[model samples]
Target: MTAEDPTHPDLLQRWNATLLAARAGREGPDPAPYGHNLLARWAEPQRAYHTVDHLRAVLDRVDELVDQGGEGGELELVRLAAWFHDAVYRPDRSENEERSAALAEKALTEAGLTGHEVREVARLVRLTVTHDPAPGDLNGETLCDADLAILATDPDTYRGYAEAVRTEYAFVPDEAFREGRAAVLRQLLSLPRLFRTPYGAAAWEERARENLERELRELTGAS
Candidate 1:
């Protein structure tokens, strides 16, 4: 959704709360401007899957993990990571994650977060490049699981997500897109565990695998 949309206000509020909590009473400039900047980034015209809706979904999934007793380290930091994770997405570019992480480093540092907090947030944002967080990395697991929770959605919803991703890469020819997308699916399927958090594994593992396999088969025309 665009910054002009109704949801913008609520998202800005969420951002404000998360930023304030992360700041821990440290003095900083008004957060509303930073929130606005991020919201506008998420609403960029080139995005289809990585839009404001995706941002909200990731944030919600992070909350779900915590509420369900999963190990979610430093909630406010995790939330900030979620916000910056895809804030600089471009389907055509491979450096999006690195750039997003850098943005988080700069923005969060300026927003009054301590060096440790900013580094953690940037590290979490970069981990999206490979959802496979090392074992026992609670914060990494939480953010990665939440970002990929989309894969465990109901069949129709999963299909819609795939379509949205395709829409983002519309510049790619269909055959090439299918090949690249199938490779991604295969890579994910090859992972020993798609959901690193215990709650995510218990609640979403099977469904996410089924969805990925189904989509892979469709993409490859496999029996």
Candidate 2:
């Protein structure tokens, strides 16, 4: 379902609550309006892969890591990052991540988060573009892994995710899209590791590689 469907008021409420909880009792502007504004952005029609469902999935992955003791006590900042990671999504724009990071910084600062915490949130959001973090950057690793969790989903779900991404880029011709998508898959395959965290690597690496290669072959008509 699209973000504008209005069937998930609870998710929107949770988004608002998450933001407020990020800076609990600190003095700042009310974050509910900002939360709703972000929800509207996610609901925009140009998005397919990057939507409210994507955000929820990232948050769920964070919870999964937390359950597995992998989050390293940075859950709050990670949640804020997830909320803003795609807040500025533009299917045709290359600077979406940078803009999203800026948005995170502004919103968090307005919400009374300390400058350090705001920087952390923005850093995590920006890392979504590369999905790479220093070896000891647990918060970055956690957010990046969660953002990419869809790559490891079951086949049918993976196919759906692929289609949604294509839909987001529907303006591109099929030939161009195929070339672009194949390039992306090849880059992903070239990575030393798709997932940075041990938990993510163990849980998703093989499946994500299979999914990526399969899609790459299909896109390039390779055997």
Candidate 3:
């Protein structure tokens, strides 16, 4: 893998191309055209979470699954879902996935997909609402776990994720913010499992547990 060899198939380049082409032509919607209009609106420079980097991370994971030859037709569906999962992200909104799904639905329609295809894409996007992947949907489960891959990263990477999340909520007061955030992390750790994929489960489970335990210790000053 040389400097220009290009690794990882994160639709980031394709997405940037879409944006660029649209801008160059000045004849269509923004770079990434969603089927729905007027989704959640985040302030400029989404800053930390929900940024292109996070989207790319999720996309990379989806691509990994696809290359590993899993998910079937749901592969592209989940990949597209990853792209638009955070499309309508707003720090102030609770129904982020609902709004993001709207955008994905619109994009699928505009892409000349059938109504069923559009709906499937929308459903995939909705899976990120609470990161609960259904047992029956292997692809959906993969994407959901990928979206939360951050939680299972090594301690140093996980710590960076925690900082990014905290930065996202800079508006909240320190005490309440720490309380709320700690509770959220703890609850996530309480889940019977973190990453749903067999490979991810084997590799990241212990590290995620360690990360969670470390965070909890920091929160209460007791290990």
Candidate 4:
């Protein structure tokens, strides 16, 4: 499927509905404003790769995996986690995932989700920071793979994603950003597996390695 247009009213409504359902029985503050706030955050000028479009891509991947009968049937929680995972992103901070997870816990709890469910969602949101899960961690594996799926896209698309990420960190000096980004690429390349899900491993591993290796070479000015 083609990339989704996050600006579309229908797409917004779809996500809004998901939020509302999370609190089906609860009488609370209007969730609409919360949804609006998330949209506004994603639209911030500093955000290039972490925009609503990225969220949509992740949600789409989740749906595709579910259709494919991948493990872990916790679809609702996974979807909710996807929405909140990057809700608090900031280029300068290392605590974005933690903050985002906390925000998810608060919002989801207020939305009437059970305490256990809310915590699970928060945990899933936090998992993005490492994107590493134990071998049997189906939800974690699936969500992590979906989040990084862009890494395995075709070269032109990967280039667009890489450039967008750089734009988000435009405040960093070129040399600093290059070194930092190259370090990140090297770390990812060193992983035994880039994606944990069976489908993700099959579809993304080789391509993701190729992208990271090439990008690392270019960033470090390697021959």
Alpha-carbon TM-score of each model against the true structure: 0.97, 0.93, 0.78, 0.90
- Determine which window of 10 residues in candidate 2 has minimal summed lDDT: 1-10
Clashes of each: 0, 0, 6, 0
Per-residue lDDT tens digits for candidate 4, residues 92-189, read 99899999999988887776788888988999998898888778888788899999899999999999999999998999999999999998888788
Give me the candidate number with maximum lDDT: 1
Candidate 3 has a TM-score of 0.78
**Candidate 2 vs 4: which has more TM-score:** 2
In order, what lDDT does every prediction score?
A: 0.93, 0.87, 0.68, 0.84
Residue 6 of model 4, lDDT score? 43
Say what the RMSD of model 2 is. 1.8
**Clash pairs, model 2 backbone:** none
Q: Please tell me which model should have the higher lDDT, number 2 or number 4.
A: 2
Superposed Cα deviation of residue 153, candidate 2 (Å): 0.7
Give the worst 10-residue stretch by lDDT in candidate 4. 1-10
The Cα RMSD in angstroms, rounded to one decimal, for candidate 4 relative to the true structure is: 2.8
Off by over 4 Å in 1: 1-7
Q: Which pairs clash inside model 1?
A: none
Residue lDDT tens for model 2, 1-223:
4536654676667777777777777777876788788878887889988988888899899889878769485778888898899999888889999999999888788778998899999988888888878888999989988888899999999999999999999999999999999888888888899898888999999999999999998888889
Instruction: Give a tens-digit lDDT track for model 1, residues 37-100.
Output: 9988998999989988999999999999999996647889999999999999889999999999
